[model samples]
Target: MLTVQEIRELIKVVDESAIDEFTYETSGETVTMKKSGSKAVAAVPDNGAHTDHPVDPVKNSQPNIQVEQTEVSSSDEKPIVETTADFDHEIVSPMVGTFYASPNPESDSYVTVGSKVEKDTVVCIVEAMKLFNEIEAETTGEITEILVEDGELVEYGQPLFRVKKK
Candidate 1:
């Protein structure tokens, strides 16, 4: 049987990872965790049996763990770009990964707000599945705004930088 602390640690790891669900079974105990938007629902079946039907662990005196997402947003959620007048071109992420502003921790950032860049210039790096991919400035422009921060997770097609075309 897993202790409460051990299970909580596992939940933390799962919440941090990109995985949406995790299940572990040993002996007769079964623990299953699922991520629902900003909250995590963790349950341990009272009977220690896997079933297709969902049950309320709280009603059965089973352990229930709820973890909140680390990132928080305002109740009035606003779009990143309110208007097209702010920029002429957008440098979108090519893959889902962690964004890096510089080549390494000790190096200066590849580009900053108002920095000029030309086609084929390496602007940043995206790390996915242990591979660091160099993202280029496919269009010539001056960076008007950076849409994402260093080490933030970005999705495919998500805008990373807004550029004013030269």
Candidate 2:
């Protein structure tokens, strides 16, 4: 199994090079990465397990969606106001794993919305192949939002938090 740092290094190398696609298999785990224009997306399947349904890579591509909020005012003449999500920074998952907001079931979350964090702060834990990896903030900021719910499966490069950088 590749460590999170190793996986990150692989991603960096691939991004710096002209590789369009890359795949690696180790100890029954398979990681596939594909580059789309300037960004790269990764998928790691557990234990080389095959899904019952065939996956359509194009249709299954998970794109980041910006949440839009609309507000309506009631008056003699009413108009709708639209707003889009905006954040200074995004903390993305470095590997495919199950996201946990805390170290243990009974423990408090490492950080919550409005929590101030340093570059080395541990914001969450991601479990992969029975190993619990503590993920860092990597930037000085205040967390504005937690994107993934607890115990959610996260893909590599998936945004886990929205932060307002200091």
Candidate 3:
């Protein structure tokens, strides 16, 4: 069995390199890693097979791997354009995790619509891997809208709050 640190290191290597997919199999365990945009997903599937000892090299052969590339048409792609014209600045999430509006469930929210904030003001918290990371507003402005709700899952670069410049 692979350790958590080993799996994390493998993910980091795959993310930094140009490789889109990676697969490894040993005994009864198989691990697959794939990159989609800026995010990476790792999956381990169960084939209902288990082996205590390693298979003989001469008896067992490695499976052939094939890589396929797909092209997207111009019509199939849709560009993302912000429709709100009132907000001049947006507070975006720095990592993929669960967004929290306040430090605790019973506490009041950090900011709301019409709340003025400075560059270093913490707007929310993103919890990832048992770590609570406070997300700060990198711009000085008044929050015009809250883009994400409390306890919502957010992706990296996802807009969390819309702010109107002072």
Candidate 4:
């Protein structure tokens, strides 16, 4: 999984790189963006099979983009996760913007290497369009890792924090 900031940076990279279309695929996820008209396209495995879908305009900086998806049946119950065994939950970004784990540049971060959090806990702030949006932990767990640094640009649905269920 990638942090929202990482995704934003990727978009920036794509735009700056002067590429028309970018496609990336991992285990069960596929992301593609075209710089011609407006939005990017995505192919993701919804139930179990690969599906073609358009990226949401509200989530991406570009609007009026649409993709389609095809749902398939999945036989497996749990996916084989690869990482340190301490974490079980992932905290994801709800919008495309910048990520800051603290209030400001001069303030200490909300959590560090092993911070514990709960649902509704203010974990950090994501700035979008000059507006500071408070990002809260939607799951209760111990902080296993922080995916991005402060002041980094992020994208919608990106992973920001990995948590270990307490």
Tens-digit lDDT string for candidate 2 (1-166): 7755565566666666899889788766666656767666555543322222221111111234211111112112112222244678888775666778877777789999999999988888766545567788989989988888887766656688988999
Total backbone clashes of candidate 4, pairs 3 or more residues apart or in separate chains: 9
TM-score of each predicted structure versus truth: 0.52, 0.56, 0.61, 0.52
| Cα displacement (Å) at residue 65, model 3 | 25
Least accurate 10 contiguous residues by lDDT in model 2: 66-75
Among these predicted structures, which one has the highest TM-score? 3
Clashes of each: 0, 0, 0, 9
List where candidate 4 sits over 4 angstroms from the true fold: 1-85
Which is the better candidate, 2 or 4, if ranked by TM-score? Answer: 2
Cα lDDT tens digits for candidate 1, 1-166: 7654465677777777788989788886567767768445455422212122221111111123343211212112223454464788888775545678887777889999989999877788865434567788889999998888887766445689989998
Better of 2 and 4 by lDDT: 2
Q: Which model is ahead, 1 or 3, in terms of TM-score?
A: 3
Better of 2 and 3 by TM-score: 3
Worst lDDT run of 10 residues, candidate 1, spans: 53-62
lDDT of 3 by residue, 48-147 (tens): 2212221111111112211111121111222224665588888876554567888777778999898999988888886543456777787999999887
Task: Compute the lDDT for candidate 2.
Answer: 0.63
Q: What is the lDDT of residue 41 in candidate 2?
A: 51
* Of candidates 3 and 1, the better by lDDT: 1
lDDT values, one for every candidate = 0.63, 0.63, 0.61, 0.58
Off by over 4 Å in 1: 1-85
lDDT of 4 by residue, 1-166 (tens): 5443455556666655667777666666555555645544332233221112212222343333322222213222212234664678887766655677777766778888688888877787766434466777878888888887776655456678889887
- What TM-score would candidate 3 get against the native? 0.61
